[model samples]
Target: MMVWTNILVPVLGTASDAQPLSVAKALAAPFDATISVVFASPSASGLFNWAYEGGFGVTDVAVAAIQEETERGRARCGELLTALDYPKTSFETVTADDWLGLRSATRLADVVVWERSAAGGHGFFASAFQQILLDERRPAFIADRPPDVGGTIAVAWDGGREASRALRRSVPLLKKADRVVLLTVPHAMARPCDGARAVLYLDDQGVRASTDVVHTHGDASPAILDAVRKMDANILVAGAFGHPRLQRFIFGGTTQYLLESLVRPALFLSH
Candidate 1:
């Protein structure tokens, strides 16, 4: 099984960041993983654009105000870390450069953890979330709530390279799960494989898993979510389908659907 020793959680200096920090602690407990919490301030260019769009021209006063806000954010993050008091956790501040600093951090992390709210929209947090998954090609855990890591885990398999990678990277979590289910939709798969193959692979890894084939005519997200809900799974492991283009990321249909529709199960995704 894959051993995860480092888990990174990038905070945007907001109250929502607390959820992911708590979730990361829970995930790290099983592996004795160390959590790296970094306060990622918004890029100066992004802040300038926001100020300009709001009719507050790019003036010295405006820039100073933005800088002050950034400092406040940093202070807030420091306070949150102090309150957490996780011994195995380390804290850092990433300013001056947003993406590059975070990118470097992601490169060293085994998995990046974030709250569900941080994974949506086109803000800095959302962009960083996508970059960690697509650009860095690292595993990420997007939690809507605290995940029950020892509970049922549902894996979405389609026999594609992305799906295979996701499954492989999730071995550590699966090994500790009380139950493992491989959910497949034949019609929706890009490269279909026998569910038995996946079952055998899991068995080889010492994680006994069962297969469940769903018959779906249209989008696969609804069917997958329905199955996950029915099984009362706490975590859904799936491949994130997205490619970076022209400095932006375009998500695949099923992946986009899952991101927008997730309500109960936390997503464990890799690209």
Candidate 2:
């Protein structure tokens, strides 16, 4: 029997209580045994201490203090997790200077967890993990309000590299769907690419897929959401694009819009 590898979600010591806590509960609710949790413990800060010591040579002392702080921070994260979540499941720590946490724990996960919007700003140390983790092309599930993922599954496709990546990640979950709807809002006056590439890619891997391109007027998010409700989709899937701005002022980006309005549980992968 092919064991459906449970889950691999990335946790930053910085996640909000609701999202982090919710993710933990979701994992433990159905498949705790097959799950492995990871907390990307990047240094979060440069190693250095500048306390005016006996003399002007305070760099070394400051560096030592920083290292101590980082190590302690890592330890504290593990200490903070719920006891039953993953008692023996080792939490991989990726130090700040590396791919996520110094080591790559992504390979051990089938699905990755991410927040719809970033929770930090300038001077934040762990924020880089967002782009890094998303670029890893792992299936990333983002949380929104309302939490409607236990029912209909809606998939957004444009067939570009972005949509292709999203489709690839969604296939694992698709197999368990009671109903799957592939909706596409093609470029204005342009024909849907038949989702040829993504469909072909999934076909090569033997994924069960079907499609429907709605010729609609307006932006992709509204149309997508309308279809989501129309198709009775509770769980939605789409490719996301996130530019690491020290601050994101995305009032018009499709991904950003959906992130802001998604009340149901949705999975989104960044390009």
Candidate 3:
């Protein structure tokens, strides 16, 4: 089974939304994993000059703000855990020194829980999300609200390495799922061997997943989304495939479509 001993949640500050943490807690509940919360607050020295004209420098103000934010973040985490009533959930906190430190923290985690937004940029969360997929080749669980646990899971299988990696990475959740559906487009075979291979693996782990090959004339993302709704899946696990050279998301593909359109439950993405 896939073991997620460290589920990382990198928050901006106390202003960070509680949805991501709630999702992380839900995901970690089954495994009894540690929810490692890393506050990736901006470093004052890097963003501001300590030596300014005025006696009170921006550096001092920024430092004070960050310190206060960190304290509030820590306290808020406690409140979230209490509100969620995840008493068995154990957690730890780490303060990243800078963007690099945040990236490092993201790289070391099993799966990252992040918020998906329409406003795309190279900001801290966006950079971490991109890096986790493009650079670290890790799975990121994107959610706008608290994710439900132990429901149906949909896996978009394409017989590629990226898809296979996503399936393997999602083994833990698959085991916990009441039903696992391998959603795929119409292929040449009755059941694509790639999907069969995943089913076999899941069978070994006691997760009975059936493959559904739907016929879609145009883009597959919409069809997949339809299947997700029809199957009543709580989560969709898929590969974060992108261009070979460009350091950006795929312009018109399943990855981009879901990232932009998916809003309800959660998306567990691996590249």
Best candidate, TM-score-wise?
1
lDDT (Cα atoms) of all candidates against the true structure: 0.80, 0.54, 0.70
What is the Å distance of residue 62 in model 1 from its true position?
4.8
The weakest ten consecutive residues by lDDT in model 3 span 245-254
User: What is the per-residue lDDT of model 2 for residues 78-148, given as tens digits with 9 covering 90 to 100?
Assistant: 66565434543556666555454522566556665555554221233235435554555555566654333
- Candidate 1: give the clashing pairs: none
Q: What CA root-mean-square deviation does each model show from the true structure?
A: 3.5, 5.5, 4.1
**Higher-scoring candidate on lDDT, 1 or 2:** 1
Residue 33, candidate 2: how far off, in angstroms? 6.3
Better of 1 and 2 by TM-score: 1
Give the Cα error of residue 192 in candidate 2, in Å: 3.3
Query: How would you encode candidate 3's per-residue C-alpha lDDT over 168-239 as one tens digit per residue?
Result: 888888888888899777632234454787788778877899998866776666777888888898898876
Q: What is the lDDT of candidate 2?
A: 0.54
Q: Which lDDT tens digits does candidate 1 get at residues 1-271?
A: 4788898999878887788888888888888899999888766677787778999768777778878888888888888878777778877778635477888887988889976665664455777776678888889898766678899999988776677888999999999999999988877765646678888998999999999987788767788889999999999998776344322211124555667884458889888
Candidate 1, which segments miss by more than 4 Å at Cα? 43-64, 96-98, 242-253
Each candidate's number of clashing pairs is 0, 11, 0
Write down the lDDT that model 3 would get. 0.70
